[model samples]
Target: MAKRFQIFLIVCLSISTVTFMLLWQGQKNNKDDIRALAQASAADACIQFTEYQTNGCESSYWYGVAAFRSFQQAYHSLTEGTNKAANYTFCNEVYGCLVLSPEISQSNISEIIETMSILSSDVEDENGYIRMSELRNSLTR
Candidate 1:
């Protein structure tokens, strides 16, 4: 009886240790994933700004697009529940840039992201082609 009890305690301890390690690792991975996602979105925004600059869109448009792209990941990261103060600052910066210009509206990015969020999941997830079409339609108007 004593030997069995000892063995049971050891097994429980090992399981607990493993569970804690897994949770810790999972959290670390989540942070890394959020950071990567933010960077990718920022890059995409930057590319759009570059396109606007080369295509003769007004400077305001360029600024707006560039600013939007720069902070997208941060905004999404926060919205997705990171809740870091740096994320709040990033959101402010992005919001400020959009608000500074009358040539473009914040709704453009909001609409774009709204569409993206919906289409990201298969049930409501609009594919890339569908998103592009929706974006183009938004742009035309």
Candidate 2:
């Protein structure tokens, strides 16, 4: 009877340990996913700014198409039970850039630059696409 009790306890302890590890790992992965979404969205802004500088408005427009998709991903990420307004701000600004991407031109680049600056300001998650400064710098150049 003593031996049986010890075996059952050990088995229960092992299962509990495994479950705990899986839960911890899931939490870590969620954080990584959040970071990745922000980074990709930031990249969308950078690409739009760069393309506008190099290719002109038309180039920006095409890239904006892609950026829109990227922003959507970022937006979806932000809304994933996180419901952060700052995060939505970041996504919306990028989405704005994408919306005008098709008509991108010297005339509008300046305005887009302004929007990017506002978006790059601060975020609920520090790991987000903190690259707005770089994007803004490119536009200013």
Would you estimate the TM-scores of all the predictions?
A: 0.40, 0.49
Position 126, candidate 1: lDDT: 24
Q: Give the alpha carbon lDDT tens digit for every residue of 95-130 in model 2.
A: 554464434324455555444434434323443434
Estimate the overall C-alpha local distance difference test score of candidate 1: 0.51
Clashes per candidate, residues 3 or more apart or on different chains:
4, 3
lDDT of 1 at 81: 46
Q: lDDT (CA) for every model shown? A: 0.51, 0.55
Any residue pairs clashing in model 2, and if so which? Answer: 57-104, 61-101, 61-102
lDDT of 2: 0.55
Residue 82 displacement (Å), model 1: 11
